[model samples]
Structure formats: structure tokens, C-alpha cells
Target: MDHATPRVKATLSDEGQRLFDLFRRPQGRSRPRPGERAAMEGARWGRLTVGDTAVVTYRWGDGARPVLLVHGWESRASRYAKVVTRLLELGYSPLAFDAPGHGESAGDSTTLIEYRDAIVQLHEAHGPFEAVVAHSFGVTASFLALRDGVRARRVVAISSVPDFGYVVDAFCARTGLTPRLRDELRHRIERNLYPGEADLWTRFSVLTGAADPRPPLLLVHDEDDEVVGPEQARRIAAAYGERARTLTTRRFGHRRILGSPPLVAAVGDFVSTGAVSGGLPGAEAAR
Candidate 1:
């Protein structure tokens, strides 16, 4: 009887579409191919341990107050070359690292907890930081790291999310894991696969401690971002309110948001001063 009856699966079908949307990044037809190769050749690359895991590091610029850029998931630090160059031009030393499992770093899967820990290690290694900039998952990890104990003058969350639950839900959506199976899978991933403890989301509440952290934050996201959505930035802005500053752009989308000049200027100004000074408040386009 059950086999003969057509079951309603619109819920699952919707889930599939959501998954597709979540993974749909911006179409960057003209990204930095030449710049990437040049940066790779021009900059000195090396490895360092952020605790047990080895992270790949890129060095550029020269100043006392270091500006660190942590890349998003599945991306190496080298990809943020444009931002690094801008930071250098702003007169601050720049350091970026490939988090574990990405770029020249060691490991397989990554978790927010591990990412935060890596940032902590990196901060300790080469900081007394003037500022830290991060994108996507790196943004979440940055929040948690700051809340832990890192002391930076300011933060720039490029395409950041405030909630860890959303991050988990995003993963489950992509993997098509039911609540029960998702729980089971999360348990397994945390226990054996990940470099950190189980239940990272729960740990976030305590780890990312802030009753409004002191440093001014610059949050950048795109309205058309199909990956993490602009709502994530809204949530963080709401949490910090005036303490939080934001820039939204059209067409920049997930990754290419870096390519926008206004975005670069915003970051540069933020590094120069705690505020997102110069040009305009919001919306940037790539050239």
C-alpha cells in the first residue's frame, strides 16, 4: 500500500534546491590568475605549527602592527593576495596562513573550533595584531578566537556569519543528513575526523565571549551572495549594532567581493583606523 501511494517529497526536493543555492558561489569569470602566480613566486612561503597542526604562512609587508588575513573554507591564504597588498600599502605588516586541510597546511577536514584554535596560535606566533580580516567560515572562527583571548585592535569580517548553528545547518543541508543521522554524523566527525572536540557549536557560546567586544568591526557581504547569504552579516550587525559597521555590494558575491575597489578601500581604511573610513558606506563593484 505504501509503495503504491505516491509519497509527498517536496520537503526533500526543497532541501536539494537549498543545498544547490548554498553551494552556488558568484561567477567570477575574471579572477586573478596572473596575480596568483605572481604572488606565489614573489612572496616567501613557509610552514608553522599552530599547536599540533602545521599551517602554511605567507609573509608580506613590514610594520610593527601586523594585519592578518584568514581565508575561507577550501581556500589557501595566497588567494587573498590583493587584500594583503592593500594592507601592505596601508603601512602595516601582513601575515596570512593556510588553515589546516587547506593550502599548504596539514590535515583533512576542518571545524570552527580548530579554525579558531589555529587563529589563536597564529596570533600568538605573530601578533599584538593591529587587525584581523576573515571571510566565510574564517569569520566565524575569528569571532570565536577573539572571544577566546586574542587581542587585536580591530576586526574585518568579510562575508561573516554570527551564528555557529547556521554553519552546522549549512553543512547538514549540503550533506542531506536527517536530524538523527546528522547528529550521529556530527558526533563521528567531531570525535575522529575533526581536529577538535565534539559539539563545536555548543562550545562557541563560551569560547566567543563578548558582551560587545571593544574593537570596531567591519562586516562586508553581498546581497546576491548565494553561499552564506547576507542575513548572516545582518545578524552580526544587529548583535553589535553601532559597534558593528557593514558594507554590502551587488554582483561581488561570495569570493569576488575581494576584487571590489571599495571593498579594498574599506579594509584599508579599517586597518588605518578602526573605522571603515573613506569612499562610501556600502555597495562595491569589481573592475
Candidate 2:
């Protein structure tokens, strides 16, 4: 593929293909919790440097085992507000942060590396964490970090792309890009990696290191989610063997999974025990 790099360069030279490019800067900033706001009539924010980029964010919760709440693509950490409150109420400390180029983080563009490093660093600062509750794109970086050797007791992937190649192909199909750009995208993945990465594709998947199973995982997905397919969630469960458990819901769309009572209960149960709650659609699940 070294010979293919020149053509890859030419393919990405198109300045007009905006859809192929990811959003470089963060969109929404976080707001303080209702209690925090009510108490002080103010909000707080902070920053941490991962690698060279500064990730601006916030932290909250109160429990023996800390939980990291990671938000999805084009979304802020504040979206997991319910998860934070629920975990906190349950006596678990939940730390939420903005991925570079997603929330209030300081960066024009972000990459999977930055996100993974941020999680690792945060875990180091406020660990040893019990689990990481990640959504969408956060799942990608979480997989990379956990697979690459970030210590965690558990990982919860919500609405994640099971395969990076699949997500790329889906985006390529949606944007109507030529197959040639796919090769260039592969080149970008190559660039995204260190000089010695043996396989770019496996390097991006959590499944690579998941087989050994250092930490158990619970994958929650919405069957009707138009964003990330349910197949991804199933693939994740299958990869983890008995260590991974999944619960699918038809009603909650992509964003609602975090706030849904059933999902929250299932996550709570899964974290406490390895068993996953079988809460079918329209069933009465706990809040």
C-alpha cells in the first residue's frame, strides 16, 4: 500500500467533498447539573491536555467505583446528564468530558487517538475506574483505548459501529464517493496510526483485544437506530463471548438509550452483576 499513497493523496485533495470530512470543532458545551446550578446559580468547566490537544470538560458523581460517561458523535458529554445523575444517585462517581472537536475542547479537528488518550489520561487521574459508558463515536475511541491497554473494570458500548470499515463504507455509500477515496481513507487510517501498526483495521476494533477479556462489557443498542445499526451491537456481544451481554430496545432511538429507564436499569444491573436484563420492547422495566 506504500505505492498507493500517491493516489490516496490525490483523492483527498478535493476541497469540495465536505461530507467525507468529519466535524473538526466541538459543537455544544456542557451545562452544570440542576443541583449544582440551583446551589450556586453557576456552572463549572475545566481542561486537561492529552498528548498536545487540550480537552475542556467537567466531572460529577459519587460512588465507590467511578464511571466514565462518553458521549456520541457531534454530541456533547452533557447528553449523558441522566446517566450522570442516575449513577450519582446510586453512589457512583461519574466523570464526563468533551472529546476534542466535539464539546468545549480546544481543537479545530479531532481524531480517534486524541479521544482514546483523553479517556486513558482521565482514568489515570481519577481511577481506578469501575467502567466506561461510551456512546457512538466514543465507543470507537473507548475500544481503541481498552484494547490497546487502558485499565478498566468494565466497558459499556451504546450505539457503536461494530466495524470501522463498515462505518467508512456506509459513509462512502451515503456521500457517493468513489471507491478510490476508500483507498485514500485507508491511507488516512494509516496516517492515523503509529509507524509500526501491523493492521490498521484490527487496530481500530475493540474486538481485537476483547477476546482475552480483561474487563467484561455490556452493549446496549436500539434496534430502530438509524445512526449506528443494531448489527454492530450484536457483533460486540458475540466478540466478548460470555463476557459481553446485550439488551436491545425498539423504541428509544439512538439518543434516548442513555435516558431510557430500561437501559439505565440494565446498565446498572450489568455493572453490578454480569447478567443482562431482558427488557423487551413495551415491557415494564424498572426506572
lDDT of 2 at 215: 82
Q: Write the per-residue lDDT of candidate 1 for residues 5-119, one digit (tens) a residue.
A: 4443555455545543443322122233566766656566767765578777777765467887888876767777777778777778888877766776776545666678777
Q: Model 1's lDDT to the true fold?
A: 0.70
The candidate 1 region of ten consecutive residues with least summed lDDT is 23-32
CA displacement after TM-score superposition, residue 138 of candidate 2 (Å): 1.1
User: Which predicted model would earn the best lDDT?
Assistant: 1
Residues 1-287 of candidate 2: C-alpha lDDT, one tens digit per residue:
99899886665666324433442334454454453343222124668897777887676643358888777666777667666666766677777787776656766566677788888888777877788889888888888877666777888888886756666777667767677766665566565433456776777776677767468777788888888888887777777787767777777888767677777776676666666656554423221
lDDT against the true structure, each candidate: 0.70, 0.69
Q: Candidate 2 — number of clashing residue pairs?
A: 6
- Per-prediction TM-score: 0.79, 0.82
After TM-score superposition, the amount by which residue 63's alpha carbon in candidate 1 deviates from its true location, in angstroms, is 4.2
State the TM-score for model 2: 0.82
Per-residue lDDT for 55 in model 2? 89
